[model samples]
Target: MSALRAPASPGTRPAAAPRRAPLTSLPGGAADRGRRLDAVRAPLQATSGVPFLVLCAVILAGALLAALLLNTSMARGSYEASRLQAEVGHVAQDVQSHQEKLRAAEASLAERATRLGMVPAEDPTMISIEKRAKVGVGEADAGADATLGP
Candidate 1:
């Protein structure tokens, strides 16, 4: 209220306060100076810091976006690694199957040879080059020459 306002007096002004009387050419009346001060300090406004807050929000949003992208990329890499592992498993199974087939073929080798009328030799002999004749060999059976090449 106007009644409760501080009265215009030298007592109200601080002892250390400097005056702008020469520069501003203020009026000599104490009432005018008091009113001028009240007008200067009336309904004072300050910065709302909207720009700083907006910048901080933008930075935070950018960080969150980067994190989301990073997470998505890592998940994609994980899925790719899993897929490659599955492929390796399949390839391993294929290799195992091939090894099994080779083992089966090796196991049937002797049986196949018997079916083809091939037999293991009871005695192994060789021709002597110096003597120009067979050596350490018994006489052959009558049909032996038919199966053995000359």
Candidate 2:
């Protein structure tokens, strides 16, 4: 019967043994065990997305706050600019009114001068001074006579 069994094919290979992991090579190795102990001793680890979501929320809140602040500042600036512009316009109008009042006052003064017998000078005289003339210090008096000719 043994001779009746066909000889094993030289090209065929035997089945390999089922491998078993050693105690140290188990699923929870030293590093995994330490991690497990740390988890038990310390607080639970946060979800992977919790911190990322918190950071996003913080960034979004910051952006909103910045936008609000910027908008408020811009609004204040715009209001101030408009107020100043209005003030400038009022000041300009006041200046124009003052100028008109001054012109009217000047005209009234001229009319009153003419009514009070103040006439424009027909012949205006100017005293001439020559280099050869010796003007004494006492000649500065209003009653002193100074001649223009040398």
After TM-score superposition, what is the CA distance of residue 51 in candidate 2 from its true location, in Å? 1.5
Error of 1 at 84 (Å): 2.0
Q: Tell me how far the alpha carbon of residue 70 in candidate 2 is from the true structure, in angstroms, after superposition.
A: 0.6
Model 2 TM-score relative to the real fold: 0.47
> With candidate 2 superimposed using the best TM-score fit, by how many Å does residue 137's alpha carbon deviate from the native?
17
Alpha-carbon lDDT, every model:
0.78, 0.76
| Backbone clashes, candidate 1 | 0
Number of the top lDDT candidate: 1
Worst 10 residues of 2 by lDDT: 133-142
Task: Give stretches of model 2 more than 4 Å off.
Answer: 1-47, 114-150
Model 1 over residues 33-94: C-alpha lDDT tens digits?
A: 56544334545678689999999999999999999999999999999999999999999999
Tens digits of per-residue lDDT for model 2, 43-148: 5775588889999999999999999999999999999999999999999999999999999998799788899999875544345464544355343344645555
In the predicted model 2, the residue pairs found to clash are: none
